[model samples]
Target: MKLLLTSGGITNNSIYNELVDMLDKPITDSNVLCIPTAMYGHPWVGPGVKAWKFISGKEENPMVNLGWKSVGVLELTALPTIDKDRWVPLVQEIDVLLVSGGDALYLSYWMKQSGLAELLPSLKAVYIGMSAGSMVMAPTVGEYFIGWTPPDDSDEALGLVEFSIFPHLNHESLPGNTLKAAEKWAASLKGPGYAMDDQTAIKVIDDTAEVISEGYWKLFQT
Candidate 1:
């Protein structure tokens, strides 16, 4: 699977272009399924209008609003009750999976529980992740980003990529998420990490990872 991980969604033209490149097709021709499970786990962003905005493309972050040929929701928490034959084929057929921003660990947990995490490696679709969605691709999100706790009481994520991410770097509203704070967070990680602002995104295809940014970002090499 290809990955386009962003702090904010496709906020700028640079990131949007990168997303198109990853798709290898026009956004208008694409079939999309958005995963809004992450929002429900977040205290401030969840189980309410915020999730609706994200699904309806009314949220500030642009994901579902990109004018795809079709858009559907894949709520991870609801997957277990249904049979795999129903949704599995749909997942494989989709061109893109738009994951929302919220609580990373909670998203990670549902991904595992819903069988999406196991199915991701075999998928041919592009995976676009915003905020917590991006963070869940890492091995661990670190304690600082931890909000909703998993049953196992671990910070472990999907580990789809080698490096971790510190998102929303230096945004005015999130005063605590400064570069210095990100640097400190990166120092505690065991592997390479990135601190990226809203306008920055990381694109990954197989083993290659590239930074596509209109804003600032720092790579902390371990």
Candidate 2:
């Protein structure tokens, strides 16, 4: 699995482009399994994965015509049915998983309820994650006690990686103050971690990780 972790994807297309470029073949030949409900403030209530359109340029519309097969959260969580016609094949034979940006807590919740949260980490396909999607793979998250939302005991992570991820380290590209903020957050962690800035990403295959992009890839620890 390839985890491409980014800060925030709503305003940037670098992560998406990178994943698309990394694809083994043209997108037309493959299907994409996208879960955008991870981010807080999602479209639907429970397990809000349907909110990816905001950043995908298809806001209010779940389906995007990218010339590839897609199974999105919008159609997955409907009460009546699981939408087996679209979701089953995507999950069983899709090319890759594309996780979009959102609050980490919400994302984690949906993954747990849907059961895909655990099954995804071990897949043979490409796994592309940005922001909250990547954050869940870390050892821990800034939940109830810390993070974008109030903590909840039920909110746990998939544990794909052994470290935690800190996004938007500089407070939205403000600069100068980022280091100070990162130092504070890093000090709070139990082990080594990363504070990735916007436009920057961490690409990990197997157990090796390479910092991608020119922005800061701050290493932190108390």
Candidate 1 backbone collisions, by pair: none
Task: Count backbone clashes in candidate 2.
Answer: 9
> Which runs of model 2 end up more than 4 angstroms from their true locations?
10-21, 40-52, 55-89, 143-156, 171-177
Best by TM-score: 1
Q: Pick the candidate with the highest lDDT.
A: 1
TM-score of each: 0.98, 0.72
Error of 2 at 21 (Å): 6.1
**TM-score result, candidate 1:** 0.98
| Span of 10 residues, lowest total lDDT, candidate 1 | 142-151
Candidate 2 C-alpha error for residue 75, in Å = 6.1
User: Candidate 2 — worst ten consecutive residues by lDDT sum?
Assistant: 41-50
